[model samples]
Target: MTHTIRRLLTGTALAAILAGPALADETIDITIVNGHPPIFLWVKHLTETFIPTVNAALEGSGYTINWTEAYGGTLAGVGGELDAVEDGLAEIGAIPTVFLPTKVPLQNVTYNTPFGPGEPQVVMEAMDALYAQIPGMAESWHQYDAEYLGGGFALDNYILMTNFPVTSIDDLAGHRIAAPGPAVNWLEGTGAVGVAGNLTTYYNDIQTGVFDGVIVFATAAAPARLHEVAPYVTVTGFGAQSAGALVANQTWLQDQPEAVQEALRAGAAAYQQAYIAEQTQRVAAAMATIAPDEAHLHTLSDAERARWAAALPDVAGTWAAAADGEGLPGTEVLNAYVQILRDAGVPLVRDWSQR
Candidate 1:
């Protein structure tokens, strides 16, 4: 070939390569929203630990990020997360299924097997791996046209924080209790009336006796000052649920740079692992300061947990079936989660009928 022709060919190939990836610093813009107050303990984690970790992870890559944090309804409220992500109002958020049960039923499983495991690390890992393997999980997200970034861990299991004493199960009867989403189901046998409540309102609501008490865990209770209002904190041994998801718009995700995609996945994994580890020890340490004095704890015997488990419906099955019908592997994901939890020696709360 002539020299001119060879030069032209080389120029075209270089242009194509440059157009492909172009090793250029890219700025990724996303929004982080939460319904709870900025001072809420869980919110602190999302702002402090999670966001910084993400920025640090991308530091050397010359990848710039613009994170717009809109909390306390600046963007959306607790029940509005699914729509926000689906509608492209926000990019990253911590949504509670307890708040949006209709949008995400599989999430209710987080509360269903409430008394699953005590340790945060174990529960976090169990749910994380479980969601990935479970059938129909992704399908549920796709229904809203979104993707899951995989931090399926949470603050802690639901505890009963009340102004009154709860030394026995019978004590919960005839009282009004607040729980998230389907968690109202867990309070059924106790004969207590369940109401919808979130972390932002529980402290004041409990103090005012709007509800006799709120069902939540230490990681959340501390910041909300539940110990001050409801001094009695019951250690129900319920595992934590998914705190927040590093979700992306399904359409936007497909357009992200491959490097950005990998970074996003790795960042979520690191955040989940680090958050679970810190929360496990933080909760115990937080409780240690209040135990045997200001606050009360109740641990169910293996027999008692079994009784509770037996009483509850097969929520996992219900969820998996729904997701399966929607073409998501809800069943498989749930089963794989149970296996991982079992292998980790995390206590099995119940076997969903779908299994």
Candidate 2:
């Protein structure tokens, strides 16, 4: 019994010596920022899904992240997230590419080619394909000192919320409407003057007559309470758009350990799935919340959708040409984008690639 006890103690000491002293987890500080508040699906996922996912991934990895979440324009205002991350004001951010059209024009392909797929996941997959196919697609973000982490932050199918009823595209005539970023091109030939605007100002702008209506997504409109101001919800089906992405400061990301980098990338992937799933589930509910009465909602007919698509100037072609002028792979990206949709069997109202 004595020899056995001695052997057991010796084995325990040997194991302890081999293990060495316990090392405390290396704590890394990371701050994530977004312009929109936690109420929005994207931002909500960052807090609920992304950070948690990163933390979960880091488990037992001998590292821990001390996270600081700056949201609701606390760290960066709408359209300023890219600047915030690039300038190192925040280590990471949800950069709305729609707001940075000139800086990241290729990311705006969906906006330029409207009336495509309504499903956000389809649009996101196409974007993923584009990023892989076009080297310049990633290079564009690199120019801003930001590393694009694919979170696939896509907007739901865009709808028009107006104070006036839109029985058809003709009803949009002579009214001023607001569209975000390159989406203004969608208003061409509709006779409605398109003013550049975003979700932050859509409610007040319409209430105060800044514009008659706003081209916005249902998920956002319900939260922004645009329904109270613009009760007429026209389901324009402008198509789900790849609007923004989760990005990190390139310098900061480069400095991170490989495990840390992998954790962040994994977190981004999980965030994308969570955000899309929640956004998709909320879309119908949001539409109902916006227009509770059947009279308040009008889905533009397929014919009207086709007419609207036909009426627009060759926005995709124009955008691509401009990108090519800048020596970026604009035309290539556009063609690849449309082709991906075609291959996926998404019914397109007009093939922007044909133009």
Candidate 3:
């Protein structure tokens, strides 16, 4: 009787040991620091669409991802977010790749060259496929000790909007224009004063006269009601951005069972596809409202656009140099990406690294 009782206790202990890790794998509590503004259309996708979709994907499997709102500064803010993730303040967060250009320069390769067609889907396709081929791409995340489970493209190309009437590039000079970081360099000789403002703040600031004009993309513009402040919109012929990634902490991910990893990958791809479709519809709806005269839907003239492209070399060079110091294959990967963009029919004035 004593021997039988001891054996039963030992068997129970062994069962507990075997079950603990698997149970932990089935449930994960991750906080998604909502990089987008709560009201923005993209936010809807992140909160309403993505969470439920990912949950459904993992439903029967008993695995789950818990995302909590950490809107911009509401939790970690722009600069400190990667640190927030690293320290485990929040298990997971959405970061804008552009915001941390110095810390994550390699991710911004698509932003430097802007001549690709501005559609969101194509830009997403190129970046997704591009990263899979580049060994350096995956390695970019490793240095930070994070795992890049998957990445999604950012909203498509940017558009120009202004509080007052502006018709031509000549009109852009001497205005208080808010430009996204890398593209801010593109605006240099054009004579626009660069004010560093992000999408989250642009709408409110634009209405209040913090800026007379803004360089922003359409997908976000409509939701922000940019038209209310800036009646004039210009669809600058440029590529969309691939600026979001779903990264997991290397420490945490390594301990997970193989089944959990597979589920996360599939969910990431689904989120990317849904975001692309959702954004495409929003951009179309936004574009439909403005009269042709008011919205100026046309590409920059070839000669003028050539001048714009010529201005990109310094921006790319500066970025590559910064990246190299971090021990990343910056110059090589940056140049290779540029060539890929060109080979795919993107327009280029000067190669950032090599043709």
lDDT (Cα, tens digit) per residue for candidate 3, span 30-88: 67665566665545566666567667777667667666767747777655667777777
Candidate lDDT (C-alpha), each: 0.70, 0.92, 0.70
Model 2 regions lying over 4 Å from their true place: 1-21
- Tens-digit lDDT track of model 2 for 158-247: 999899999888998999999999998899999999999988888888999989999999999998999999999888889999999999
Better of 2 and 3 by lDDT: 2
- Candidate whose lDDT is highest: 2
Better of 1 and 3 by TM-score: 3
Clashing pairs in 2: none
Q: TM-score: which is higher, 1 or 2? A: 2
TM-score computed on alpha carbons, candidate 1: 0.82
Where model 1 places Cα greater than 4 Å from the true spot, the runs are: 1-26, 60-62, 289-295, 313-330
